[model samples]
Target: MVEPAHPKRRRAASWILAVVLAVFVTMGAVGCSPSLGSPPCMPPEYRVNPSSAKPGEAVTVSAPDATCNPRYGSNAQIRIVFTDAMGVEVLNTTAPMTDKGGFAFTTEVPTPTAVGEVAVYAAPEGVDWCDDTGTNNRAGSGEDELEMASCAKPMKPLTITK
Candidate 1:
């Protein structure tokens, strides 16, 4: 006949099994789970040298380096738009993501055909919500625009002139 297992031995075996199971669960969670969402994107700092320009003149808009989704998302892009007085998009360019988590972009102003009080606007790509009629929008051409309502500081739309 087999002797009954000792109480202390049984407890020890149970404790070891519990520990092993816990380790597996923890490991799986750490290795398999996607990263938690990163902090919201910082409002890009934008500047244009020679704030005023004539139609077809080259202007430069430079802003300090920044991150969109930081390390959490790929395919992140920044779009810089130049709008003429007629509220028409004259130049719109999308910059590619850099290998590092940050992206600092500088581009020469696109030449405008319409001229007269041109403005520069910058934004992250792939946004769907745009309000042209609502008060939550910028005054520009008919393009749909999303109001970045929750930024730490209200972003002033950059502008240039002819």
Candidate 2:
């Protein structure tokens, strides 16, 4: 019988290659697992002045420059949504982008049947939620962040009182 040269080295190399292949396969499986959902979008620099306010009071909502992609240009607009504790749409308004790609608008707070706190968010008018494009269609891996679009975040909760 003819024996191969350096049998021990060949065996070790084969074993190592098998282990590496297995690890790669396992990683790919977990990364592409459908159990994971799209990763959360990156938070914007949204802010609500006077975090607390009364019904009908004027409050300013502003997002600093670079909050939203300026690529949208001058025509771009941001929708400022105010949702009450009950998940009610208390106020919804659109603010035009400033020269610096930032937005500032003042609007009166709306009265909701149940008012303890209200969440203020500024969403880019034409932006979409982040989605996973991986084979498994899962998002939890955070790879979505690289391709994510603008995402709104809750500013300091606005308190509403009688």
Tell me, by lDDT, which candidate is best: 2
Q: How many residue pairs clash in each candidate?
A: 2, 1
* Model 1: residues with Cα > 4 Å off, grouped in runs: 1-37, 67-69, 72-75, 97-112, 127-162
Best by TM-score: 2
Please list all clashing residue pairs in model 2, or write none if there are none.
37-139
Assess candidate 2 and give its TM-score to the true structure. Answer: 0.55
TM-score (all chains, Cα) for each model:
0.46, 0.55
Where is the poorest 10-residue window by lDDT in model 2? 133-142
Prediction 2 global C-alpha lDDT: 0.64
In candidate 2, residue 138 scores what lDDT? Answer: 20
Q: Score each candidate by Cα lDDT.
A: 0.53, 0.64
**Tens digits of per-residue lDDT for model 2, 94-162:** 889653347788988875525688878776665442333322212232243444435434456778877
